[model samples]
Target: MSAATPTAPWTRTRLRTSPGTATALFLLVLLTACLAAAFPRAVDRYEDRGLRRTLAAEAPARLTVDVTVEDPGLELTPEQRTVRVSDPVTHAAYRKIAASLKAPLTADPHESSYGTRSAEPMPALDRWLPRIDGPPTQLTLNAQGGLADHARITSGRLPHGDYTARTMEAAVTRDTARHLRLAPGKVVHFPDLDGRPISVRITGVVDPVRPSGAYWSTAPLLRTPEQRSTESQPPTHYWTAALLLNPKAAAAILYTTGRAQSYWQLAPTTDTLTARQLPDVTRSLASIANGPGLLSVRTATASDTADVGSHLGDVLDRYTELRSGITPVVSVAAYGTGAVACVVLLMAGGLAADRRRAELALLRSRGASLRGIGGRLLAETAVVALPAGALGLLLALAAVPYGRVLPPVLAATAVVLLACATLPLRAMAAHRRPHPHGAA
Candidate 1:
């Protein structure tokens, strides 16, 4: 007989490769890995966008309340009263008063009521430390009980007349630095309520300070009373406040005919409330309080991206244990399912051997040994391993970005791929067929 025609070396076709089926499955795995990497960010964007939509649908609102002396013949001066009111409870009360007036209030404490706006506050400086992971709210003091002793007012200028200004070389809280808009060396003017100029020079950037309560996240070592008393001059009682500029600064602007309707119109028309507006608003609020007032504006319709991040923190804290517990269970179930599919496929391959019996007989008639047939089939299945492994590894590499956040899922997928390779091969044996006449 002529020498058996030699088969081409190492082609997938020689390996009983189901190119169409394998390609489709390979693409599916690849797509899944890609989705694993990118889907979380997409989900976050969608959530924030939806929140904006929801807020827009809600009613637009604004309100202003005066904190003037309720007591008759009050002895305290306006500045003295404002200073004494600078504590946390009084701050919350301002929000309470705004809420009572039916305003949708979100408080910000970094927006200055008085004094110059500096991006590099002591709190922002503290954030540069390596172990400081969260926001400024949790900023801790050094062993000496100083949060950031290195903090200093780098430059002071009277850019806007009579507002003694000092610029820190660091980032200030967002309420204060929001005016900076990431533009350094630019002039940001804060004016008093009477349009009197209050100058502040921007030096650097800072973190945005949000409202207190469930989402509160920043803490700086407050100046002690001794430090306050020992100072050559007393410090201004600084407070951050957000006022509604759209609904008109004062209720007097509300027309009796339709105050609520006018408020709605006012809300949308507030196209811009600059950093200058905060001083006046703070003064406005302070006029009510009789102290140095600091104020900024926040839109009821706007969704804060930082707020969404806080929500994610809540999700982790609330569901971390539950998710951790469920993850292993789900992974095991999924891996077992993949293993079962591989096992079933391999068993089915044995059934395929029966259908090919006649073909095997023809080969044997030509003097082919059972060993050769088994060797050829084994070689074909083993050939699948390289492509499969390569595909799995490529998928794993694609999973890197997502694995930064969701590592466990990506790891489980790799394990499944490895299991698929070995278990399926174990299903089939390469033993020779018995002789037709039962002769060994």
Candidate 2:
């Protein structure tokens, strides 16, 4: 009988012989630690804009756009000074633009009422009138900031229809109504800028916003000295009471007042817009800006601006930036560390396994089955990898925010197993167990 060959312990014996193999496993754990350290910051930067859960939940943002006064010198009609964006011509133009872009547009616009306040006081009743400063102002609610949609009416019904110049009804804020002691169904008289008598019956009251509970202005009702030119003298004008009217009514008021005294609000149809579509929107609005009697429109809307529209390039740009943003140095460090670790593990494992070919050959000669040898080697790999994975996880927790844990540990284990498993295959492939005397 051939001499009984001792069974080479696949795991313990292999490790005892090749201590250097641990270096590859240690390097994998170190790389995993590096990934863990950088992961939180990377994720945080991504979440800022890439996936906006907040925006999805909130209503679409609206922008305020001030219609710049073109002929501050000429006493032009509001219809003349400002293009009626809600009119058929402008609406059709926007529709064409929308159709061309294949985008949904919210046609609702907030056209401001441009009439002057009725300077004449109410008929004397008692001494129950609240003290009010500044001139009374008339303003119309356009598509963007309509009374029925945004405001809460504390009393009475809101004025119906597209605020026609003919609908002699008006909605006042709670503060304005309280100040004038005006109630629903009360007829109020006011003079247009041309001193034309305009009588509008109070229809409802809008709830004031917040702790002050005061409705100051339908829009900014203050006029400073600089707003005046040689044509517009007595520059300082104040608006104490604001009347909210629809576009048609506002146009009527504007016609009576003979001035474009307010801004237009603009917004896209959808709640959100993408960066790719901004250029088309900007161009579409450019057509309107070039229309008759309208001044050049601004490309970007500011926070204070009343309209958010014409394709929402600014908002889209912000979201795009968030999605694409990367941590400049950390991104490279984390990825590079992982790739290098993989390469190192594979090379070191192969070398260590090559050295253990003799041990595998000895096991084979001892009648140890291939399945048994593979099992032992695989178990040995798990033993090293599992502990290294745990250690890597601990290191990661200490280094980075606690938001992450499992990914690094799992990654470390996977890397170690891959490296260790590859070793056995390379060793088996290269090994040649010499046939014993008289054995095939």
Candidate 3:
């Protein structure tokens, strides 16, 4: 029988020969890969946390779209001119404007409030005592969309539909009622520009469930009365408040006042927002403000002069500025850490290469080709680096899973490739130099 063929030394045996070096190299590679995979994800988490905090603390008015159209009644068609203010056709026109204003908002968990208010304040007078005149008050006829949801009736009940009646039903806040000494069943009158007295009967007193809530921000004056004084020998104190009226009375208020301002408040919930959606939200807000969305709303409502106002863009801009200020600092820190990691990795690789130099030289002397020796070194390093890198990446993902996958994947791949290439390149360089004893 032929002699058993001699087999080359196993790769496992070579690795087992220097268990300490292998363990150290594996640990170094694992740490580097873990940091590479974790940095971006950590940054993303930090940014998301900051974004949520900023949004939660911001006022509702800064993040809502407030659309206002003045004197919608003046845009009535010739055929619509003869219709009564309480007619369904007239109500439909105002509803159409509200629908147009709400059409552009596509964000989830959003709320809207639309109403008509007299453009100018009228002096409020008690019907029973004509001599006592109180502060100026504005009449606002609003749909019960989110009003009842955010306010609680303390005295009577929500205003009922009395659009066709001579006196419209209204509700006043607890503060307003107290300040004006008004209560349920009290009759209040305001003289319209047409010289006719517009009468309203208070049906209830309301208190806000959450005074600081976004819903209240839509109509601040309704919850908190405004106080103003003129500069004179004795400053005359003036209080302004808004009286909430049934939605059905919108056309009557507009018609009686001759000109009224209509408002649509669109408030998007901050809880539904994410850092990834920042750019999209900003663009959507901008589109609603001046782009095709605004044009479409104007065209649909047939109100060419309607104006859309929002501070959402400005809020997003502040966020961008904050991010920009922080990004460079984070980049510099990452670069510094990466440079230090590279230096440490290079030192470790150099040590490992130095340790294997004698073995490599001995193989070269035994007629092994330089390519063969370099290939063995590369294979050994890859055996340790690739799996360690993968495990590190898995650990990072399990810890903080928030950022784009591509960046972390590329970082781990680059680290593994560098680890694989380092040993072979260093070995090849050391072998190429001329030996003083002319050996191998």
Pick the TM-score winner: 3
Candidate lDDT values, in order? 0.31, 0.47, 0.71
After superposition, candidate 2 runs with Cα above 4 Å error: 1-45, 49-146, 161-167, 175-195, 208-237, 240-242, 246-254, 258-326, 336-355, 359-440
Each prediction's total of clashing residue pairs, residues at least 3 apart in sequence or on different chains, is 17, 23, 0
Q: Indicate whether candidate 2 or candidate 3 has the larger TM-score.
A: 3
Q: Model 2 Cα displacement at 143 (Å)?
A: 6.4
Q: Mark the regions of model 1 whose C-alpha exceeds 4 Å error after superposition.
A: 1-320, 361-372, 404-433, 437-440
* Highest lDDT scorer: 3
TM-scores for the candidates: 0.31, 0.45, 0.83
Models ranked on lDDT: 3, 2, 1
Candidate achieving higher TM-score, 1 or 3: 3
- CA RMSD, predictions in order: 20.7, 11.0, 4.3
Model 3 segments beyond 4 Å from truth? 1-10, 77-110, 127-144, 230-235, 272-277, 367-371, 432-440
Model 2, span 15-64: residue lDDT tens: 78657666566556556545544465345434543434433432232222
Q: Residues 75-143, candidate 1: write the lDDT tens digits.
A: 446444333223232333334333322112223222211110111112222222222223221111111
What is candidate 1's TM-score against the reference?
Answer: 0.31
